[model samples]
Target: MKKQRANDSGWRGSPEVWFQAAIEILLESGVDAVKISTLAKRLNISRTSFYWFFADREELLSALVDAWKDKNTGSIITQSEAYADSLAEATLNVFDCWLDDTLFDSRFEFAIRSWSLQSREIQSEVKQADAIRLESLSRMFSRFGFSDLQADVHARTIYLVQIGYISMQTKESLADRMIRIPDYVKTFTGEYPKQNELERFYYRHGYKNNASS
Candidate 1:
């Protein structure tokens, strides 16, 4: 945590630096708490420095929305685009988002959705993001030989389940989620994952086998 005053120090003053602080505040408190004064104090910088990066607080909020779009929605689309030998494999790629925060942060998602409650603008952005994400999941299913209707339904099922999980603030341990993952993949894709497919996913994520645990 590099905390320093603007006049007496070496703050990079990067937009991302400010954006990060704002996001932290947004998650911890509500969007209203993401004020320039609060962020300046959090970053240990002068309030004037914030204007250098954002014209206004709304600009900063928009930046947060863009960040959520890029990280959460973009990542899922990228995973959906990646090569998968089977439907289950493709489903697991999406599953990686749920398991890994770096890929799709549930906290950010929840925070943004919460913010949406107060602003139609944010709500519209969230809806658009949902459409993009669902489309990506639908395409992933289509590539795996599912018909259009089937792909659409499966995509909605996969996406809504995760959204519902976040909205409900469901709590489950990593080990518990890992134990349920294979069954989840199978149910979504309608085929049991082969051992190798399961192994690849588990090894990539460093999940210990439940049986061995």
Candidate 2:
């Protein structure tokens, strides 16, 4: 047998590379399909390389959970904390996750939620994440002058809507979603966003009006 190189695909058999491959497999074929041999074959590297990073399959699975926590939950909280002049802007910042994948991986969210069905540990983690997200959103609303009760309610509404979208695997074109954002902002915040705020958001996310289309 030919000796396989460690640095195939310029990845150097890094833990992140393994985690990324595992996540891809998890998304495509569920958690059970994320076996070590499958990943080594998929990456075109030796299975031994995996041992250097992870002790076993369980370790890789734990890394997956941590990655999802850090990437999806952590990113959204950071976005929520970003400076915004108004509640509308803060809401828009949260909305960016729905419009963008780099900040929030809806697929990952769905995968973990599915995984949670099979394991109590994952279920507890998901529950904690949900609470943290809800708290962050509620604080955003409170900062915008909503009463504590109102903020919590609004936060739950937004969180549930987003979760529903992910759970149902809803799909909408970027333009269609873009058109509805203003209405969503208005409904969520009880005020339409300012023109400049809307413009800045569009520019930041590269949304085009495409009037002719």
Candidate 3:
């Protein structure tokens, strides 16, 4: 990951690289190591190259959180429509996405959670994002005929668990996470876990098997 430090000039690459680098360094090292210069160096670009996409550090942070929302919340909410077979399937799909999506990976969630300690803007964004996510869960539960207030309480609990679980470093497989998440969802709504293998939620995508990074 060693590279030349980017100076604010060219579009070295997509803003995604900077966001990804910021999360990686933030998790592996800490917020102190997530500066624009650090990201540029990580990407083998110039520090100033950051400005080609983001105006300042705060903007980069905001963009990171926003991208996180798109992956963890927006995509899940949209795909929730296709999850008509069962509520357990839908909820697990969202929870599994938390682990599988690069935007909500352990690196980024750990970073944003740490960065939120000082940045009120990021705190607000995080709160807003969580609320939206809970709402999506609530709506999904209601679609399965769960009561409104019950859905709200259950959704909040499930959402918190999903986020908390992200920070857990386990030797479990993506399939294990996919298999286990349904227990949390069932706990939240008092719904029963899938009794048959056919009804269990299974992830259909590949998690980047990042062995070296």
Per-candidate count of clashing residue pairs (backbone under 3 Å):
0, 0, 11
Per-residue CA lDDT of candidate 2, range 92-149, in tens? 8888887778889999999999999999999999999999999989988888788999
Residue runs of model 1 more than 4 Å from their true location after superposition: 1-12, 210-213
Off by over 4 Å in 2: 1-12, 210-213
Q: Can you write out model 3's per-residue Cα lDDT over 13-58, one digit (the tens) per residue?
A: 6566777787677778877777987788778987877776777897
- Assess the local accuracy of residue 74 in candidate 3 as a C-alpha lDDT between 0 and 100: 75
**Weakest lDDT window of 10 consecutive positions for candidate 1:** 1-10
> By summed lDDT, which 10 consecutive residues of candidate 2 come out lowest?
1-10
Candidate 3, superposed: residue stretches over 4 Å from native = 1-20, 167-182, 193-200, 203-213
Each candidate's lDDT (Cα)? 0.87, 0.87, 0.66
- Error at 88, model 3, angstroms: 2.4
lDDT of 1 at 70: 94
TM-score of each prediction: 0.92, 0.90, 0.72
lDDT by residue (1-213, candidate 1, tens digit) is 223456633454767788888889988998989998898888888898777667888777878888999999999999999888888888888888888899999999999999999999999999999999999999888887789999999999999999999999999987888888888887887888888888889888888785743
